[model samples]
Target: MTLVLVRKLLRDVRWGLFAVCLLLFVFSAFWVKIAQRVTTEIAPFFNGVAAVSKINPKLFDEVIFKGPGKVSQAVLGGAEIRFDRPDDFLSVELLHPVVVIVTALWAVSRSSGAVAGEIDRGTMELLLSQPIPRNRLILAHLIVDAVTIPALVLSIVAGTQLGLALIGPFEVDYSVLQKLDLPPMVRLPAGPPVLEVHAARQWYAVVNLAALVFALSGTTMLVSALGRNRWRAVAAAGLIVIGMFVANVIGQLWDSAAFVRPVTVFYYYQPQKIWLKENWTVDLGEAWAGGSPMVEIPVMPVLIGVGAIGYLLALRVFDRRDLPAPL
Candidate 1:
């Protein structure tokens, strides 16, 4: 019977679901196109560099081909050290603002309605009249939301892959250059290593992205359960999401407000940074940690923990709260 209600709720929220998914998919496609355009604009420079390397002779032994150098630095304005990795490229595309914000809002809307919307619409009284328990009903709503968040995340991933494929191969063959044999350096093979797209890394970033959205969804649901009405619920959840994002972004500019970052969810949910810099520390012992000391912590688990805590609290809140009388 709970499952029936869950299915019915799913049907009820179809419009919101469609709108959220469509917006995310479009943003994903749009951003990928922009990235591709940037790549195209810069591809000629790399080609010219490759040509020059042929005459330079010593360029063949250079490690530039294996890393994220000129293209990332010149085209994307990204740091070469970070963007040089395969996963960093995918992380840059998949972890866009549109995907994260929209997915979180979707969770906010669905969660806000769990108990508050029904009460405000004067339907809560009747819902409690059914044999279905309040906790089950709320859980069902969250379950539906949980399913949708991942779908939205995937849309972004697909858009990134599509963009990469559309642009064709973006590699620069360094083999055309003459080998430089400098003593011990001669041990290194004089081959033109290539730099190109890796599809697998995109999925890895997406996996972390999914965790991020899931955490935001659950946190919003918790706020929803706390509010007395749907509007209040939405506001509370929206403010937190916006606040955390703002704090994270601004923290980059100011050192004083840096303390606010750790408490905010954004501090712990950077797949791009982890994959790009190759550091996975979660203790955050020092502010932001700046990808050092190698804490070896998994971000997904912390995000999941936050989500679980939020849902449990929401369940308790809804179970104890009194439903409003129907008009």
Candidate 2:
């Protein structure tokens, strides 16, 4: 019976799922292409800058690295931007504002319709009249998430691989004569070096992204369970996601607001950090250690816990609340 409900729900959302998967796949490939262009174009310019800056130590180290570089770092989650590793460059795309918002919107759209949407459409009475238990209904929706979120993430993975294949491995171009204002025939001595993108390294961040989607969907499901209108539920969940995202960004840039990060789900959505880690393990003891979001709190587990709690609360509320009369 639950299987039937899950299948019906999947059929209803299949088109929406396909659209999202296509969008994610295209965006992922596009970002990879952008990274490749940066490698080919910007790499030489940066090389020229460093070479010329050798005449004035302050130009490279102080003016560029510490000045504008710091701002870029803060905005991109506070890690030094490493041009040498193209994988790091690719990972930056995953953390882009567009990617974050799209994934959150997917969650908001799906979860918001679970309960509140039915009630809003005067279909909750009809749905409940079926033998499907309320818990199973929610479970079926969760099952939908389990299927769809991976399709979205895997689309990104496939797109990235496709882009990487198109670009081939990184090769440094020392042909800096045209890009810089150096004396007529001067050529660059060295170019940036990079390793091919590894499947495992990318998976680390992919898992983090999945965990983020899970957290958002689960949290929004609670909101959906509480409201009667799907749009209101969407607005509420969307606001929460935007608020947390803003807080996370601000917290990165400001010391005073640093305290607010851990409480926001975005704090755990560190794709770059996870990509750079040498090892992965979960430690509950460090969940809130040092009152900073920098602590290693086992990203997947913490996020899953947040989602679990939200679902449990939604279940409890959903079971007890009475439905309004059909409009």
Candidate 3:
């Protein structure tokens, strides 16, 4: 029965799923190209900054990079973004508003519709009339999520690889490197200033994205199970996502608001740290302790915890709650 329901759900969402996957693939690839273009175009400006940094490092610190740098940090996942580095620049593409919003919308749409949508469409009574248990219905949605979320995230990675293949390795300005005053031990490239955007660096980021969508799915599923109207559930879930995203951004920019970081789900979605610092996990105790300016919070565990708790709560609620008559 669960298998049948899963198949039905898959069939129902097949076209929508395909369209979203295709959109993400094309958008991600285009974003990579765009990042590459922007990096190349801004090379001179960055080089000039580097050259001037040698003259008056405090000029940028007190003037340009101080006030405006926080804005960049907030947007790019709270790090000093280096446009020249392929990993840094490419990570920005992943953190783009379009990518996050598209994936979140997908999660909200599917999960909010899982229970409440059935109720709204007058299908809940019919579905419940069958021998199938209520939990099995939710399980079917979970199975579908298990299958689809990875496909959606992998599409981003595949698109990125395709873009890298088409655009070839990124070219760095040697002058920027020289002017930045590297330590005496570090060797500059003797040949053309070319750096490959390694796709492997993004593997964890892909995992992070999957966890993000999964958490969102479970959250909206919980909301759906509690509600009778799909649109209302969707609106609630959408607002929740937007609120957390805003809170995360605010925490990055404002120190007083940093208290919100430990609570927001977006706080765990740190692709930039994964790419640049090779930081994969954080101690929950440390995250709560909150000493560092930017501590890498636990990504996989918190996301999975949120998803698991939401799923369990939704299952429990759906099992006990009385269903309203089909509208």
Candidate 4:
């Protein structure tokens, strides 16, 4: 029964899955170009700042500045490092929201007809006529849908990583050249240049993608179980996803309006704080010194939990529901 269920789902969605994987590869390649452009444009500004201050160029070139504060004379006297300019890690940070929206919409579109559409088309009755129990049948479908989420996400990650690796070195050198204060005549002895990629930020983006896919997939699955047809399920899921995005944008724009924050799923997804260079700071005095927005934002564990619970409830509803014959 489980094998049959898996086979049916694979047959139905394999082409769609292939299309999604291809799209992800394209986006991954796009990101590499974006990263290169940002590196080329921003690094020179920091280098110019360092040169004007007459600080050790190496320190400013490599070190990512977190914040601006007065350096104590004692610390300055003993320190070998002079000025630190924050790395403009905005490329990935800026791109995070786009990735979230795309992935959520994709998941919703895929899962919107998982169960209800089958029932509406009278295919559910044929499946149930087999030896498989209703509960087991619904469970099998849920499992198959759930597995696709991770597979899709990992494909995106792998493609992104491969693209980045290919272009990362050129970007790093371009950044260094843009930052160099010397005249065209004075060339520094070029050795093997060090490339520093923020692995943590990339991993965080992947985690965010996974969380969103999990949430949206669960939501659409529930809608599919409850909705009368594929069109209704898709509409409901699309409305929910779009509404969440709009609410989030409104909350961000009017952050002082405390009431709006709770309504936005965006409030919980703080990619800017986690990925941006300027927001990453350490304050010695407080337990949580850095004022990264992510720190203040409430985690959406409840949303995730509710989504999971909803899917289980949906399976139960689907198991008991009667399937009408097709016209």
What candidate 2 gets wrong by more than 4 Å, as runs, is 55-72, 178-187, 192-195, 279-295
Q: Positional deviation of 56 in candidate 1, in angstroms? A: 18
Off by over 4 Å in 4: 42-98, 170-195, 256-258, 271-300
Error of 1 at 252 (Å): 2.3
Error of 1 at 300 (Å): 1.0
The local distance difference test score of model 4 is: 0.58
Task: Write one digit per residue (lDDT tens) for candidate 1, span 101-189.
Answer: 66667767777787778777877777778898878877787678677767777776766666666755545333322243335533322
Sort by TM-score, best first: 2, 3, 1, 4
Worst 10 residues of 2 by lDDT: 282-291
Which lDDT value does model 4 have at 33?
Answer: 62
Task: Score residue 299 of candidate 1 by CA lDDT.
Answer: 74
> What C-alpha lDDT do the candidate models reach, one value each?
0.63, 0.78, 0.81, 0.58
lDDT of 4 by residue, 190-225 (tens): 323443555445555455556657777777888898
Candidate 2 overall lDDT versus native: 0.78
Clashing pairs in 2: none
- Candidate 4's displacement at residue 137, Å, is 3.4
Q: Give the TM-score (vs. native) of candidate 2.
A: 0.88
Can you give the lDDT of residue 100 in candidate 3?
91
Full-model lDDT, candidate 3: 0.81
TM-scores for all candidates: the values are 0.76, 0.88, 0.86, 0.70
Compose the digit string of candidate 2's lDDT tens values, residues 182-229. Answer: 675665556445546664577778888988998999999999999999
